[model samples]
Target: MIADDLSSKIRGGELSPGVALPPQKELSARYGVTLATLRQALQQLEDDGLLSQQPGRGTFVAEPRAAYRLDSLRGFAEDLRAQGHLVTTQILGQTVAQPPAWAAAHFGDADPAVRLERLRLLAGHPAVHQVSWIHGLELAETDLSGVSLYAALAEHGIAVHRAGEALRPGVLDQASATLLRQPLGTPAFHSERVTYGLDDRVLVADRATILGSMMEIRTEREVSGLSMQWVQLG
Candidate 1:
């Protein structure tokens, strides 16, 4: 947990870039944990590519952030293909419950949440992890397992009006790395997007962190019709 907190602070920009953390001894004292525990935490962070240890230079944080252009919206699947990558999804599990706080907000304060976990693949390589939540009643009659999620909703008369998104860089722990098939030190993209129906009615929300190896995105200013860009993840 200490290691995770440290990673979060550094990733969240609380520690800032080029910031040098205290020596192991000082960190141990400050956190009130033993040297062994401190080292363990630090090791975990290093494994997640959040930090680099310098034999005589202590440890330095890593720097990596996706440069998103201001002009376009890239759908996850289409974006992967635009990059000449193939995107695939492995639906891991699904459950129904009250939507989590974040999902609740996106789904118009849904009383029931449909949670789905999927592993995203880019060109045959496991990339981002996807966790989608939808309003239960809205999707209750839908048969998932295949087909685009956005399409499924539309078929049910849910008109997708727009989507809202948030993004941040975060360290990859063992579990996340394992899921992405990368070493623990890899960087992951934490992202959240909420889709709204017509009249801005909440339809569904998806949250995920794409692995670095998967994609790149930028928006373009077009004078006329729609213009799109993407590179498939798998």
Candidate 2:
């Protein structure tokens, strides 16, 4: 009950971000709870991402997480740039290969797809690790350094018309955690997408792992309720 009350206040904007909570003893007295119970309540909020506790320092409300918009065919780099952030891309690996199970499920016997792995940074901070499998083009002769897969495909006269995405909670492995600068088993967001080009041809099958602390899924629904847009924060 105490945790829920405090969480409601935080979400309702009564306790602004960066604002420190009351001292444990005082807070416990005000809430009519024991110190132990109050501490447990605060710990619950901390685990829920609403509070931050520092050693020797008091707890404070956490800042709002970044979000990503999914209403368009925008690339990871493009989305961050729109938020006035400097974006950089590092191509980890790129080659032609057989599609993985997830990719093959969408590509449907489209062997020899161009596979590319990338680590994208926002303002020098590691943000997302992504891998993509592109079909309907020969990317072996094309250069992808410093360019997004969407842009490279566009150069080959393939225009993305529509895309579908799925997102779920995940945990980072040792390899992914090292690249994203997070501890092993850290909470993460796992996203999969399939992009379509002209005539409904599949252009790209991609998967991405995003740092949960640095990103979230946002959706806006207009008052008229006719349209809704989904965005992700990185």
By TM-score, who's the top model here? 2
Instruction: Tell me how many clashing residue pairs each candidate has.
Output: 26, 9
Q: What is the C-alpha lDDT profile of model 1 across 1-234, one tens digit per residue?
A: 788788789867798655788899999998999999998888888766577787888877855433334343445655455544456778787778777777776565658777877786664677778888876566655655455677777778776777777666776888888888788878666778887767777667888877864444445565784455453543
Candidate 2: deviation at residue 70, Å? 2.0
Candidate 1 regions off by >4 Å? 1-75, 82-84, 108-110, 141-143, 222-234
lDDT of 1 at 130: 83
Model 1 — TM-score against the truth?
Answer: 0.59
TM-score of each: 0.59, 0.69
Give all candidates' CA lDDT scores: 0.71, 0.83
* Model 2 lDDT at residue 185: 95
lDDT agreement of model 1 with the native: 0.71
lDDT of model 2, residue 217: 72
Candidate RMSDs in order: 15.3, 8.5
Q: How do the residues 158-195 of candidate 2 rate in per-residue lDDT, one tens digit apiece? A: 78888888887889999899999999999999999999
